[model samples]
Target: MLQSLQSVAFAEISLAGDLISANRGFYVLLQLAPDSVVDHVGPYINNPSFTELAAGAQRAMPGQVVYQGLITFLGELGEPRSLLARVCRQGDHLAMIAEHDVRENENLLAAVMDLNEELAEQQRALARANRQLAAEKAEQQRLLQELATAQAHLVQSAQLVSLGQLAAGVAHEINNPISFVRANVATLGGYVGDLLAIIDAYAAGEALLAQDPSLLARIHRLRERCDLDFVRGDAVAVVAESAAGIARVARIVSDLKNFARINESEWQVADLHACLESTLNVASHELRGSAEVVRQYGPLPALHCCPGQLNQVFMNLLLNAIQSLEGAGNGPGRIFLRTGRQDDQGWIEIEDNGRGIGPERLPRIFEPFYTTRAIGAGTGLGLSSAWGIINAHGGRIEVRTEVGKGSTFRIWLPLSRTTSE
Candidate 1:
């Protein structure tokens, strides 16, 4: 059975979110016992390279994969395990992730990393196009960088540009190929190693169980002990995996195009609900099994705002909601989204009935990396980006959360549908 994974077949993995290991092959794979990964903690390894590489990968990959880097986990017993992980991110941040099969050859990893070069190329082309259309795009990118850090430019002159003062044409030329390559990254996001793992585990265990009759006898003994009369009815078990995959292609095309459009200028009107719906759809297959999302959107009007940027806002909020539930525990937690109107005020609220935030930490919810979640589990930009978008649209964002109850975010926007148009 494990022999099948070596050739070709896709499998799902739990190395990133819930457990250190997940293979469709059988419970034995989970029981084969991960040496280092913790049963409750999942795969969280202590390694700097893993984090940087995963971050770089997430920055590069667009549709299917979201790199979470190397994770270390302590097994059921005293053992440490490491795994490369990623999430599915069509916008910014990750929704789903997995650790892939490790390649023996380092060169293969380097070759695959070419996708980043492609993303860079896309940004480059977008920049050149921006230079021609909107004079402020360069500054916009720079300002975005500043938004993440303490870096800022006190400009006395009217001209706007990046802090690097980089050679724009050269950047463009280099980025062209990058954009070309990134377009295909989703195709490669398949967790081939994960798919191979279950079969691999079954085969690995079957082989070991073959060497000694005691192991087989022990299995039979445990089968009765655990009430596993027909446990191994089928010789092989396949992991259940669902990604946007082929259906995701169209959405990918739409996002890339929208990214290009939004990146071109800061002015555009978008349906806030539509953007949220798209982000939810893009992240749908990723969140289906692990968490359940409940949305309650009230009547909303078309917003004269940047759809791409708004999509980013929706992405951040939803991701934060998911992470909150994840951090709370693997139980039945609910995430709710509410939208409605209040005369001159219209709001979109995202509420999570998961782990709630404290009053002390509540003040800094929008601060960069200000998270209650474990270190690697969060970047803390989701709410902040949501804040930035809602603010830019002439809106207000506030959080109402309790330490144990849950967290709720209310984003107020001026209904420009009637005013702007």
Candidate 2:
């Protein structure tokens, strides 16, 4: 125990509160005592404070060991000296070891204290660096998550924007034909009523027929007003075209309602034939101006799918085919839409004779934001969304195209095992 204590920084204290003794290490370090041999006292060492302090210590302490730390004075080195001493302890016996050897112990102790201070500083610096690294890691994770979320939202927004522009353009083209047809129907209704009244007078009796030239005159007047000569060639063609036009308008409105239906609870298994027809009806206005549509239908099974969303897929495919044609330029432009079911596989192909995409562009056609169209023309989400929907239904899509030829998009839906669910 004593050696372990000695191995600590060398220190010695007197048995009481006065400067009876100090270690040589302490002596060289701070001159707590004037003489070098203080740790081991020589003969004739004397001081009343030491004696009194020892006596007081024994009295105060009773049977315990009496070492009390205190301040005392040592003789000064210079002439006309300043009295000097530092706080130290007094001991009981005045004389002990004979020599002062403190320089090495003092130097080692000072060096150890300095090293301790340096170690403490290093520990604090390491802790600060660890905290900073943790904070940076957390910040990086947060930014990565935000980036993923923002990118997903951007994809959805871009898709909706493209759909909006397509809807606006298609609606405009359809309205013009409907407006003319509606007006012609109202005019024909009036002309038919006049002809019916004139026929009633001619059949009334000879007297009524011969009453005056008024009936004949009235007939002539009606014919003049109705433009009989123009109607001779135009009326039949106009009425036939108008009937077809009104039906087209009604069909488009129905397709729009079915395609954009938000009331999902009303969903049911819809026949592919009906769905295809309605989709073509709604899209005809966009396609009519640029491409002729031909349908080749083989027997197909009804799909138990989200009607509105599946219609959206059709709309996307049909529009994409049309856009490809427009890019090619008008000429022998045609879109062939065919549907079939065979060997438990359902298939659809939308083929167009238009400017074809290159081999490099084809692979990325279904990727979001991939487009060959000019800016403001495409968001490139059409095929991607269609792809997603088809895949969700346990299906897949295939594309075939070559330069200056055209592209054919084929969609295949397999028989789902998960029964209508």
lDDT of 2 by residue, 1-421 (tens): 2123222223333553233433443343334443444433211123324455345444542222233232232332322211122111112322111112245434443454454456557767989999999999999999976774466446754554455456655666666767776787868856866775675565566465565788867866887998766765575576667777687675676566555442242436777777777778777679776888888988788776666556677888888878778757647789998998868788888899888889788778877666888999887777877887677678889888877888898888764433345
Per-residue lDDT, model 1, residue 267, is: 61
Could you give candidate 1's per-residue lDDT for residues 89-118 as a string of tens digits?
333433322234645223323333454456
The local distance difference test score of each candidate is: 0.54, 0.60
Model 1: lDDT to the true structure: 0.54
Q: Locate the minimum summed-lDDT window of 10 residues in model 1.
A: 156-165
* Model 1 Cα shift for residue 117 (angstroms): 70
Q: What TM-score does model 2 achieve against the real structure?
A: 0.51
- Model 2 residue 261 lDDT? 44
